[model samples]
Target: MNRKELFEKKPRIKINDKVSYCPTSAAMELIGGKWKSVILTHLIEDKKRYNELRKEIPGITERTLSLQLKQLETDGLVIRKVFTKKPPLKVEYSLTDFGQTLTPILTSIIEWGLRAAETKGEFLLDE
Candidate 1:
């Protein structure tokens, strides 16, 4: 679909009463972004520093990573902690209880994607 058609297709929300867009759809409006899932996947392990996450996920630009991290923090899925230390200092990120709940969901998505790729003989590209 073209840009105009896509924009016109998006569900709109109403404020007070009347016929309004679905709330669940609006929630996905925030969470349904590309890098959100990948950032959450990395945090599923353990608390990681900004640099550590960058190293783990290859090919992600620093700017994009920063944006994703900020968004996740805003959504309350990830908590950012800053520590006072020596020269470089430190910042760490860990999943909140809310974020931990998404692990199984992400695992399922990964499994489904793998199966889909395998059936299409495109799984090799993932490796």
Candidate 2:
């Protein structure tokens, strides 16, 4: 499908009298977890295999990665692809077209984080 059609099919919030709860709440529901946004940040650059994701994301357990990926897939923000032609199966994860629309929001957050780190002296994991 074309870009226009893809955008048209994306989930959107319609504002009307029938609407309830804050729109921010809806966003949080999809990306509120400790690891959801982190996972998304890693995916923003390119599609990554499961092990590649684990290696890139520090402190993430195998179980957490699996669960978060499953949730993201269910929420229509991520696509999971599996290849099974060889001895070891390969699984890749990428953002859906709708998910790519979140680039602005994610980019803003990343910028803010870098600014904060400037004063905070950065965060480093203990070795």
Candidate 3:
């Protein structure tokens, strides 16, 4: 369908108290922030401690990472596990079953990013 017709006929869907005209947009809203998908991509391999995530995601501040993780957990996409009941607490973050469903999608984004960098720009890992 043409762009105008598509937007005109499709009814909006609502979930989690957010209204969205497109499902993709709604999906984006959930994983829309700068670090959410990156965080998810990292967690795809295995659960990680909060500090491990901080080290892997360069440039992300402690506040932002913590906020993103909390949001993800609230959305039922991530689980936070605490293994200690006292000082020197140990915590780990892992994806929920629903979050695992995002594997292909996140992988596709990662692959596309590589393709874009190689074709249009360049990889600066050595620099």
Give the candidate number with the greatest lDDT.
3
Model 1: lDDT equals 0.81
Q: List the lowest-lDDT window of 10 residues for candidate 1.
A: 14-23
- Give lDDT tens digits, candidate 2, residues 78-120: 9999999996888899999988888789989999998898877
Please give the distance, in angstroms, between residue 73's alpha carbon in candidate 1 and its true position after superposition: 0.2
Off by more than 4 A, model 3: 1-9
Local distance difference test, each candidate: 0.81, 0.85, 0.94
1-127 per-residue lDDT for model 3 (tens digits): 7878877898786767889999788898889978999999999999999999999999999999999999999999999999888889899999999999999999999999999998999877765
Residue pairs with backbone overlap in model 2: none
What is the TM-score ranking, best to worst?
3, 2, 1
Regions more than 4 Å wrong, model 2: 1-20, 121-127
Could you tell me the lDDT of residue 94 within candidate 2? Answer: 99
Q: Give the per-residue Cα lDDT of candidate 2 at 21.
A: 58
**What local lDDT score does residue 93 receive in model 3, on the 0 to 100 scale?**
100
Full ranking by lDDT: 3, 2, 1
Per-residue lDDT tens digits of candidate 1, residues 6-125? 567875664323344765555455457777888888888899999999999888899999998998887788999999877578999999998899899878877888898888768345
Which candidate, 2 or 3, has the higher TM-score?
3
Model 2, CA-based lDDT: 0.85
